[model samples]
Target: MSESSQSRPVKVTVTGAAGNIAYSLLWRIASGDVFGKDVPVELALLEIPAATRAAEGVAMELGDSAFPLLCGITVTDSADTAFDGANAAFLVGAKPRGKGMERADLLAENGRIFGPQGKAIGEHAASDIKVVVVGNPANTNALIAAHHAQDVPAERFTALMRLDHNRALSQLAQKLDCQVGDLSRVAVWGNHSATQFPDLTFAEVAGSPVDVDQSWYTDEFIPRVAKRGAEIIDVRGSSSAASAASAAVDHMRDWVQGSDGWATAAVVSDGSYGVDEGLIAGFPTIARDGRYEIVQGLELSDFQRQRIEASVAELRAEREAVGDLLG
Candidate 1:
């Protein structure tokens, strides 16, 4: 067998290459530790034409890292060319709401971006390409992207929820004054929106309910995790970009490297949770063999069900808003 064929190098494409997530994501992917020591990675960066120069600067820094397992780097404005031969893709770019912009406008703008990018990936990305969307309005944007990428597996597109999941776990731990390692199976449900339900009933500390008799829930817990995103925005005067970026790295890392914990993510539905079959919705999941299977049959309390349904409503609304644009 040929030595190069034996190695099976992975090519990772980062769309929105000049964005904050890509800045953090590229360095980690190049370090070879992203997929562990044995797997080598080639980075392909896709940036819009207006952002290409800044992306080049990011690529220059990647060159300086000198990571041993980084096989190559390719940067381009063409999504088709950038995604070509890619085994994994991080869809992290989208139009940010300028001052006074509406949600419909944001969805419309992102539809324009993800639709073509999705088509490009479908046309040129390797057959095994696994895509994760990190941009805002992620769930529907992933749906839009997935719809256009007909050749790619529908299961291949997913949106980021690891951040919300991690945030929920950390807040619960801190409120209970317990270590984060003690928490397991925490679920972040519905859209990656203000209404997302962070269900802790099934989460365990020593295989027991995380509430420990409801002390944490009634106290400073739920609000802390729910408001964490706004907290960052309040303190920073800008929405989270670093912690968000860090979450992107963690999502791709665990997806490629393998992990034991159930990582929650917004994946396109196949009628899970009664969410519309094509709308991407967040659920508790475990990633195995580079795929995520939502943990099923969780017992949902009335309160939790209401919260998740609210978020699902938001996602469904986004789908409707972007419906005409999808074509």
Candidate 2:
């Protein structure tokens, strides 16, 4: 009934010890982001040996904070050990886009890492374990990990869609001149890549339909959110790490903590909207009972359907590319 009861001691595992996002996320989890005031929790941090000290730095911070609900912390290089008994595992480490590498090359590099981690999770993680991929090329990387984790249900795996979902919420708020909390029903469709589509057709800004122009949709809004990652990279000289971390926390918080009145789009296994069964696809979703179910039977306008399909096409192409690489 409570967060700890629903998952228990909530053995949370975070990959990438030296990474910026994981650093941001670890302390917050230790401080009891989801477990509430009375619940207890333990943390298992996974890092490469090179970054174990940094992880320890974070562990030291946790101890210094002296959060009452924080029971214990463990840092390790072994995925098997880090994931053991973990109720939730966050895959946050991945190779980023280098100067000369293509997208396929990046996906291939991540596949090599996530595949074994997936198997480790399947073999050792707790029975109700849930995974979220926060690294780049998240959707396909999640597929790779899920495919390798043969023992786990495909639906148990998910990639972070909170960034896009938040972008849409923010945009709707701007359009309607209202607060983000009042906006609901926004959806992001298809891949998490540059091709993913944000659908505002059913979303309400301040409880009213968002009136946006198609020209602005094509010229301004869609491109803005889709390319926001790149813009962040240009300005910050690093890929989006902080906001990505925040989105990851928001995602797990919403998933384990419950959204109540709010629902956001998340990329889960495609069981809704006619997407192929195993591919990671985005849809309007709410997290409850340790699982996310895609909101079904929403009315779609002609324009929205076309845009969603376009994004799905891109996802299918990536799937094919990865499948070939696996072969």
Candidate 3:
């Protein structure tokens, strides 16, 4: 280990640690790809009791990798144990939406799970622990968690919309035949589901403002990015794990290390862009010194306003469905 690695280690807790997304995420974090290579990390991995054995297997693999920055690892079935003194957390475990189930069903089911986890975090985690909810119905699930975790600052909890944001960038880059890094300021608004608006109105490509074909933007681009998960499932026989994990890393890393440009995340809104106050919604954001702030002063077009309203409505409905969990 280097001298830097000998410094105080940051503790990171990941729920659903044996699941596919966590499987992809743990290795990157252990290798210091999320936090700086110089910053040592101790991983606290959590899963249900049933998955404890699988989590042990994952720990074995992590041990085999011999990550120089990884100082320690703990696998647990208890949230309180997993979150104890955690500096950061990834809430990647939730009951997935099964076939023929409605979105409300998923939200209610996850509410039961996140509510307890949130209470545990509030009671056991570090006061500054930053959380990212990566499971499906993530925005509302994050809201439930934050609501229950009253001791933790509500802003510290956010949902994973970086996946949608990255999807938008990739789709635009493919159309323009440019690298994904050449794009900036792309934002995904409102919910993480089909109602999301992947707006390019504020985006720039290759340092020039993007002026895309309206027909393509409406017909091809928006749907492609919004439903990319379904598209992947159709082609790959499974829902996205790798891409989702990569986006989670991007979200947490940029959040802690500072973003190079505007990134999108689903954060608790204080009525920005007319989103309901206290709602967790996606917005164009920037991170600095380990905090995320929604980008301010950007004027939205009428088209953007209408699309955003539609999505916010969906979020409001979700909040209503899980109203009891909020308390």
Candidate 4:
């Protein structure tokens, strides 16, 4: 906890340090892009035992970068070691869905990975640790992690829905010929999968409410944003890594620094927007003072409601599939 002129150097743990997404993420974090330029960080990078050598290689690269805000680095294969005293964690490790694999199989595999990590986090992480799951099946993985981490407040666990949020922003920007930054209040609701609803029902472009054709919103915009991952894979022959990493940074940055306005994140629902209680569902959120609250009083149109319900239903099925892991 060494203090710089700005703030104490906080310990941040990142799982799956050797993976593509984490490879993109670590340099950004070490350079203080996720935190602030003045706020230093001690990175605890975790990989599986087989990837320990690769993790060390990453540490070597970080050393070469010589980032001013990077106070220290620890590379390990053990969750307990990685999470010990961690002020923040990115649960980026999970079994990816392979070719011909069913959704149920993917959920079960990730459950095995996240369950123990969650328990370790509950026992070893800092009292105020904030966690975000960047792994596949993220929303339900987050739900599993939060369920196991009883010692940590459930509100601290979130899944990355910022990717979907950003995708919606970009698609809208492309359609309207506006800068992505010019749009605000773009909400991504429900799961991170194809079922996610990128609700522009309340969005504004350049300080004016956007009124667009309903057909375009439904037929083109929503599907494009929802399936952006597949589109990336089709173009690149790989899953999204850099964009996912960037979105994770955005999610955590706004979370730690306070989003000036609305952002979308998958947080454990307090029954907001009729989402089932205890489910980690994406919703319009505000991050302030190092905590997130689901934005209240946004009236959902019937279309939005039905879309969110479909996504939540998928989440519910995922939960039931991993029911044994919840304990």
Winner by lDDT: 3
Which residue segments of model 4 deviate by more than 4 Å? 1-7
Model 2: per-residue Cα lDDT over 92-133, one tens digit each: 988888889988888888888899899999999988888899
Better of 1 and 3 by lDDT: 3
TM-scores of all candidate predictions against the true structure: 0.93, 0.93, 0.97, 0.97
TM-score of 2: 0.93
What global local distance difference test value does model 1 have?
Answer: 0.83
* lDDT of candidate 1 over 2-69, digit per residue (tens): 35632977888998899877787788778765666667888888898999999999989998988888
Model 1 worst lDDT run, 10 consecutive residues? 211-220
lDDT (C-alpha, whole model) for all candidates: 0.83, 0.80, 0.93, 0.92
* Candidate 2: regions farther than 4 A off: 2-8, 324-327
Q: TM-score of predicted model 1?
A: 0.93
* Cα-based lDDT at residue 133, candidate 3: 97
Residues 278-327, model 3: lDDT tens digits:
99999999999888899999999999999999999999999999998875
Task: Output the lDDT of residue 145, model 4.
Answer: 88
- Candidate 3 residue 284 C-alpha distance from true site, Å: 0.5
The 10-residue segment of model 3 with minimum total lDDT is 1-10
